[model samples]
Target: MAAIELRNIVKVFSDKRRGRDLLTLDNINLDIEANDFVCLLGPSGCGKSTLLNIIAGFEQATSGRTLVDGKQVERPGSDRGVVFQQPTLMPWLTAIDNIAFHLKLKGVAKAERYDRAMESIDLVGLRGFEHHHPSEMSGGMNQRVGIARALLMNPSVILMDEPFAALDAQTKLEMQEELVAIWQKRRSTIVFVTHSVDEALVLGNKIVVMTKRPGRIREAVNFDLPRPRDITSPEFNDAKRHILSLIREESTRLAQAS
Candidate 1:
C-alpha cells in the first residue's frame, strides 16, 4: 500500500463577503509511495497548499477521504511534519530549543531532547548555529531551522508548502541542493507544494500538475533523470518544454471556457 492515499479529495471554502462558497480543490486523487519525493506543481491559487494541508490534517476535505499509513487523517498529528513558507520559529528560543520544543512538551528529558534535536540540526547543516536564536539567523538559516524542526519529528511524511519560496536566489539553490541530499540520506516521503516548475523539476521524482482555480490534477509525470540533473541538458529542456506545453494548453482551455 502507498504511504499516503488521497482518494477523490475535494475542498470548498465559505466566502462570507462574497455571499457564495468557493470551490477550491476538485476531485484530487494521489498515491504517494514510501520514500517518494513528490512535488505538487501549478499556478497560484491552484489549491496545492490546501491539498497539502488536507494530507497534513490541518484541513479536512469537504468530500473524499485522506489516508496516511492506512489510517484516516482526522487532525494534525506528529505522524506528519509540516514546514510552512515562513519559518515560524520562536523568537525567545535558540535554534536547538525550538527544534526540540515538541519533545519538551511531551515530557522528554532536556538532555535527550537536545540530543535528538542535534541530529536534525546536523541534517540541515545548522551545527554551530544551533545555539543562536532565530533572530540571529539569515532567512535561509531560519528556514533550515524550520526544516530541522520538522525532521526532528521523524514523521512518516514531511509536507512542505513553498518553504524555500522567500529566500534569495542563491540561498534557494543552496537549500534545494541540501534538501535533496538530506532526502537521499533519510529516504523520507515528502510532498512539496510549489508554483515554480523549475523548483519541482529540481527536487521531485514525480511532479503532479494542477489546473487553475478549482484545482484538479492535470497529470502526474514521473521524472527519473538521475540525481544532480544537468538543468541545461537537452533531456531536461525536453521535459521542461513538455510540462510547459501542458500548462499552456490548460490555460488556453480555461480561457476559452470562460
Candidate 2:
C-alpha cells in the first residue's frame, strides 16, 4: 500500500493585494510507497514545500484529497512528522528536553521522557551535547535535534522541507549521509523538499521533479543507487544529466511563457 496518496491536488492562494487567486499546485497526483525516500525537487516557488505542507496537514488543498496509511488527511496528526527549514526548537530548552517535550506534553513521566529522548539523541549522534540549549549549539546540531524529535514520534511519514539548506557545505553533506543511514535503519517513508539537485541525488531513491510556479510532477525518476553514492561515477553522472535536462527544459518553457 502507498504510504502517502495525493489525488488531483489543486492549491489556490488568495492574493488579496492582487485581487486574484494564485494557483500553486495544479492537479498533482502522486503515490509514495511505504519506506520510500522520495525527494520533491524543483526551483524555488514551485510549491514543493506547499505540497509537503498539504500532506502534513499544515495547509489544506483547495481541491482534491490526501490519504496516508489508507486514511484521508483532515488535519495534522502524530502519524506525520514535519521538520521545517528552521530548527524551531525551544530556545531555552536543552537538546534532550526539547526532544522530549512532546512526551512531557503527553504526561509521560520524567524518567520515561528522558529514556525515550535518549534513543533519538543517540540516533542523531548528539549523545554528549544532550544538555546544550539551542542557542549554545551550531545550526547543524540544532537541526539534528529537530530531526531527532521527529524520529521519536515514530511517525509513518516524515516531511522535511529543506532541513539542511541552512548548514555549511560540510555539515550539509554530513547530515545527508546521517539521514540516509537513519532511514535505512528506521525504514519510514520520507518526503523531502529541496531545490538542490545534488541533495536530491544524494538522498532520494525516488526523485519527483516539479515544474515552475503551478507545480506539476514533470517526471518521477527511480534511482536505486547504492549507499554512499559516488558523485563522480558514470551512472550517477547519467542520472544527474537526465534530471538537469528536465529542469533546463522547464526553464525554457517558463521563459517562453513569460
Candidate 3:
C-alpha cells in the first residue's frame, strides 16, 4: 500500500463576507510511496499547503479520503511529523528541551529524553547548540532544531511547508543539502510544499506540480538525477526547462482566460 494516499480530495472555504464558498482544492488525488521525497510545487494560492494540511490531518477535507499507511487520517497524530515555515520553537526552552518536549509529555524520564533528543540533534547537525534558545540561534540553526524535533519522533512521514523559505540564500542551500542527507540516512517518507521551482528541482525525486487555485495535479514528474546533483548540468537544466515550460504554459492559459 502507498505510504500516503489522497483519493479525490477536495477542500472549500467559506468566504463569509463574500457569501460564497471559495473552492480551494478541486480534486487532488495522489499516492506517495514509502521513503519517497515528494515535492508539491506550484504557484502561490495553488492549494499546495492546503493539500498538505489535509494529509497532516490539521484540516478536514470537504470530500474524499486522506490516508497514511493504508489507514484514513482523521486527526493530527504523532505518526506524521510537521515542520512549518517557522521553527515554532518555544522562545524560552533550550534546543534540546524543545526537541524532546514530546517525550517529556509522554512522561519519559529526563535522562532518557535527553539521550534520545541528542541523537536527533546529531542527525540535524545541531550538537554544540543543545542548550541554546531559539532566540540565540540563527534562522538556519532554528530550522535544524525544528527538523531534529520532527526526527526525534521517529515519525513514519515528515510534512514540511516551505520550511526553508525564511533563510538567506546561502543558509537555504545548506539546509537543503542537510535535509537531503537526513532523508537519505533516515529513509523517512517526506511531503514538502513549496512554490520555488529551483527548490523543488533541487530536493525532490518526485515533483508533483499543481495548477492555480482550486488546485488540480498538472503532472507528477519522476526525477532520477544522481546524488549531489549539479544544478548547472545539462540533465538538470533540461528537467528545469521542462517544468518551467509546464508552469509558463499554464500561466499563459490562465492569463488568456482572465
- Each candidate structure's TM-score, on Cα atoms with residue i matched to residue i, is 0.98, 0.98, 0.98
Each candidate: RMSD to true structure?
Answer: 0.8, 0.8, 0.8
lDDT of 3 at 17: 98
Q: Write the per-residue lDDT of candidate 2 for residues 133-243, one digit (tens) a residue.
A: 999999999999999999998999999999999999999999999999999999999999999999999999999999988889999999999988999999999999999
Superposed Cα deviation of residue 146, candidate 3 (Å)? 0.5
TM value for model 2: 0.98
Q: Highest lDDT, which number?
A: 2
Q: Which stretches of candidate 3 lie over 4 Å from their true place?
A: none
Model 1 Cα lDDT, one tens digit per residue, 191-255:
99999999999999999999999999999999998989889988888889989998999999999
Query: Any runs in candidate 1 off by more than 4 Å, and if so which?
Result: none
Clashing pairs in 2: none
RMSD of 3: 0.8
